[model samples]
Target chain A: MRLSKKGAAKPDPKEGADRTKDVLGGTEIRIAYKMGYVLNFYREPSFRKIEMELGITRPEIVTLIFLNFREGVTASEICEFSGHLKANISRGIIALEKKKLLRRDVDKNDNRRQRLYLTPAGRALYAKYIPALRERERAMLSCLSASERKLFEGLLDKLAEHVPHWTALDEL
Target chain B: MRLSKKGAAKPDPKEGADRTKDVLGGTEIRIAYKMGYVLNFYREPSFRKIEMELGITRPEIVTLIFLNFREGVTASEICEFSGHLKANISRGIIALEKKKLLRRDVDKNDNRRQRLYLTPAGRALYAKYIPALRERERAMLSCLSASERKLFEGLLDKLAEHVPHWTALDEL
Candidate 1:
């Protein structure tokens, strides 16, 4: 599609220096932007593939992939791992449940909690979709050396360690 | 602000792959994401400062900076150097013009082009903002050694050479 005319307004350029100082001028900031750009690019095309082939949005696919590894995981748990906020996960879960791709059950142990599990359909989707996801990842990362990948990941883990709330929010 | 309702949604679990691939994988992807995120964070905050105190976005700041270096530079050229598009450049010019931070005059050499130059107010803003921009940049690169920074930037340049549009769009 051509660019959206309504979205043409430039983003708000005014924000406070306090928030800016939080993540500014660090290895984390530089790496974050570069990766964010690539990820955005990577997602745009791959999402088109997911939408066309599986009838899923990019975010839903991410949630679905998580469900494959930890069945019956709580929404909170999902949020912690994914770095997405709870609402997004809830929306994806709702959409997936509607499609019969997964089911969300109340946690017997914790009434305030909900556990999510993939339905057979969800599993089938995973089986069919995982290779494409993997392929996209490999293509995007093809430029890195093994050693570089290790160092880069270690640095991210360091940064992730610092963002506890973001991590916590990744869980339901 | 308190977390938005959208922020309250459960997070996805499968962001591991993205995190792992981009960061731990030691590829340029991590750097790309970090740089994009931090630059955006920094730029937005600075722009906010400008709006509240000086009233201009980074794009306009970019125009000012480029114009200072080479008087009467065209919008297209500024857009190219700033890594923003023509539409963005146009919007920035409009904003700057409104603020009287800068002026655009028809290029005597090329009517299809407009040359940008900072007003005295713009020059003053540039003197103030440039140091902050550089400081933000220095802080972001702090995690790496000077040599590492060199290597990292070199690698980024190589990637840019390989994919001139890598930073331009979301099409991997």
Candidate 2:
């Protein structure tokens, strides 16, 4: 594995107990802390793969992911859903448009409303992207059983519903 | 809440069914997608807070988070557990040692080994860093119940242990 390529830098798993205790002592919440760490761990490879394969940056891929799932969405919906900045999403929209992978059309009822969708080419690229990325996901969870995976996915959605609060607590 | 301050960008709740099907059609996995989105959603504020409070970058804060939990670890162990690049971790160690927030000592049994630990000043910075950052975390998960939080944490650990494989499928 790329992560373990160099034997010198693998996690000293024996200290797992002390790591958990000392890190969790102050916050009383360990999940989110570890969540941040682990996601960062996976982020580089994901970026490397996506960039090499699709030639798009992280934000653009995120925007494409959103449009792939929800066709006819406005740029604003992407901002809300993906937590990307408006400026970044706009740039992504423009970049994809320049590549002819995505197109935006005005809503029939509202001239001001722009709807975004993947072009045929974009859809084709998305097709190529799926298997490679999903394989990584599958391998990552290969340790879990089908039932455990179910429980795990459900728990993820449960926490995901809180996306709205991610930034709002600053006000409080 | 910051996410809802402008009603226009909110993800339409009713689109859940269609969005799930459409998005997963390409990838067959939505949980990791959402996890990536939601985590990025919280990252900015956490970075902002840590930088303001502790004068550290995202990678630095991540290193500090690791050391906070497991003091007396080597830089390589940090790379293994935190998934940061060795070059980056080494740089972080140098920066922290320069700041006098962290100290490294040679192992008595192994003269070649240098172990890292937080200094009193580092502990003080962590004291300031916790409440501000954990608040964002609390807000991000305010939607979950106490029990759900427990399940969610356990599941995250399960998934996190799989970090090594996230990018290793190329060999498979």
Candidates' chain A TM-scores: 0.70, 0.77
| TM-score of candidate 2 chain B vs. the reference | 0.75
Give residue A43's error in model 1 in angstroms: 3.2
- In model 2, the runs with Cα more than 4 Å from the true position are A1-28, A41-43, A106-113, A165-172, B1-27, B52-54, B105-114, B162-172
**TM-scores for the candidates:** 0.53, 0.76
Scored by CA lDDT, what does every candidate get? 0.55, 0.66
Q: What is the lDDT of residue B43 in candidate 2?
A: 68
Docking class of 1: incorrect
lDDT of 2 by residue, A2-110 (tens): 1223333343433443453343333334766677655665556666678876788766887777777668888766765566677888898899999999988998877
- Second chain TM-score per prediction? 0.65, 0.75
Summarize candidate 1's per-residue lDDT along B106-167 as a digit string, tens digits: 86756787767778987887787666656655554565677766566544433323222222
lDDT for model 1: 0.55
**Superposing every Cα of model 2 onto the true structure, what RMSD results?**
5.5
lDDT of 1 by residue, A1-172 (tens): 1111122222111221221222122322343333433454445555677778888875587677667765776665555444445687888888999999998888776688777889999999877866765565555555667776566545544334333222233222
